[model samples]
Target: MPISLSRKFQQWVSAKLDLPEDVIMDIPRITMIGHLHLYIENHSGLLSFSPEEIRVLLKHNHGQMIIKGKDFVIKTILPEELLLEGTIEMVKFIKE
Candidate 1:
């Protein structure tokens, strides 16, 4: 139940499956291409969307991701992945 124990368990699972710790550890994987494109993996939900901002929910205590930019548009949305395209200006995390 403690943080240290949970971390150890996550590390063990990561090693066993040859997977990145973030995946097993319920963390979002975000990839950005310059300031024009964004890709997110393992997102829980979309909290808000607009031309200038976007908020996505993440698992665990990672909370929500706030993306601010111009001409923001969702290129794709799947059960666990999201692709956004726009002129990205800032990215921040809002914890629960």
Candidate 2:
């Protein structure tokens, strides 16, 4: 994918100002607590959810995130954030 001038500017500004790229670039922020709790910020949408698998759409060119676990349960869900609880086994990011 080709990046726009605005994206380039944001990247430059973030680097020059020593700011976090994830905030400026619309990247997803993922936080994992042990193997049980998962928090995702800046997500675009939820693709699918189940006890064993969860898929999320990311913003910009960040692609999609696939989480595989057991006995998964959602704690909080919002327009741009999600919280999941379960025995997380694997996490994968796929660009398509």
- lDDT for predicted candidate 2 compared with the true structure: 0.93
Query: What are the models' TM-scores?
Result: 0.84, 0.92
Tens-digit per-residue lDDT, 28-54, candidate 2: 999999999999999999899999999
Q: Where in model 2 is the C-alpha error above 4 Å? A: 1-3
Write the residue-wise lDDT of candidate 1 on 32-60 in tens digits. 99999999998988999999999999977
Best by lDDT: 2
Lowest summed lDDT window (length 10), candidate 1: 20-29
- Which candidate number has the best TM-score? 2
